[model samples]
Target: MLNEGLSARSPKPKAKMNRLYPLLLLVAAAMFAYAPFMILAAPYESTMGLIQKIFYFHAPVAMTMFVSAFVCGIASAIFLFGGRLGADRVAMAAAELTSILGLIVLVTGPMWARKAWGVWWQWDARLTSTLVLWLIFQAYLLLRRFGGPGSDRLAAGVALFGMANVPFVYWSVNVWRTVHPTTTVVPSLQPGMRGPFWYCFLAFVLLYVSVLGVRTRLEKRRAELEALYLAVEE
Candidate 1:
């Protein structure tokens, strides 16, 4: 009976592909191709030279990870309070994508740090908080896998709680002194670095949205597949 109840709650299958989806795919591919070149050519060339270009990818990925976590928290809250299954699915999708991007940032950050700071790792506040956030999402995914009947609710709670660290991570450099430089360059609306920086930032944001959309669609499909599998068992 519990199995039946669980299966009943799963979502229905999605429809066939549409025209807009293809356009999104094209845009995603274009951005992926364009981002690396812009990063390499950006004007704020560090003493480390071209290698410092990794900063473009690292910082933007970190920013998008925070955005994803915030969105996940909001969706999780809606799911818990309103019992909205779509919201729950969105939260799950966001969490999964955030985890992936967080891993990318973690890897790229160390590379950039090694070049810029002459160390592969450090115990700075920003680094520590970012790692904490990554671990929380890792734990969230694990709990979902083994949590049994209340998995959705448990994961939703984790998502909401884990996201409380987002602000701390963002402000960590300001909140406390650290070896990591406060800003990549001096702050200005029209700074010398603004051109390539903004272009790279936009490319990354577009890439993130594309990847998130694809992952969410896959999650929805997986939910439908599980539902079908249960129906067959019955």
Candidate 2:
């Protein structure tokens, strides 16, 4: 009965998504396909030169990662206080994506820093805080996997902390004297580079939205199956 009612209520929204999912995927694909060329064409920074070009990928994806953390944090908040399982599923998916994107940011960051800062690792404020944020999401995932009963609430709470850290991470460069570049980098971009940077940023966002939709839908089905099993046991 639960499964039947759930299935009945879901088709309309799913159908509407079906109409838009393909288009979203297509646009993201088109942007990603041409991103390389745009990055190559942009004028190199006077200082960082070829290495600075990585900013096109690194910065935009970092922006997307931060947004994903917020999505997870907000969804987790709703789930924790509202007792909504759908929000929990979204939080889970967002947590997963955040971790994935964080890896990219962390990796590309050191790549750029290696050339710019002459070091692959730094214990500075920005880097450490970013690592902490990534670890928080990873811990959330681990909790969801191994945390027996009532883990969702606990994971949601943890996700909230990760969300709280994002602003600190973003501002750490300026708040303290860190070797990391300041936030001014984006706003100060040269016109030649600004176009590609924004192009890549939009692409990452569309890609995030597309993936989040698919992951959230899958999580819903998995939740349904779990519910059905519980019903059988009862």
lDDT accuracy of residue 83 in candidate 1: 97
Q: What would the per-residue lDDT of candidate 2 be over residues 1-234, giving only the tens digit for each residue?
A: 476636644677678985677799899999999999999999878877788988899888888988899999999999999999889989999999999999998998888878777789755565666677888899999999999999999999999887887777668744664555433232368889989999999999999998998898788888777777777887
Model 1: how far is 95 from its true place, Å?
1.0
Model number with the top lDDT: 2
Encode model 1's per-residue lDDT on 1-234: one tens digit a residue: 335445544344433332345566688678778766665555765466777667666777887888888888999999999998768888888888889988998888777777766788755555667787888889888999998988999899988888776676657644664445543432243354566666666766766666666666667667767777777777
Q: Give the clash total for candidate 1.
A: 0
What are the models' TM-scores? 0.79, 0.87
Residue 132, model 2: lDDT of 76
Residue 87 miss distance in model 1 (angstroms) = 1.4
Model 2 gets an lDDT of: 0.84
lDDT (0 to 1) per candidate: 0.72, 0.84
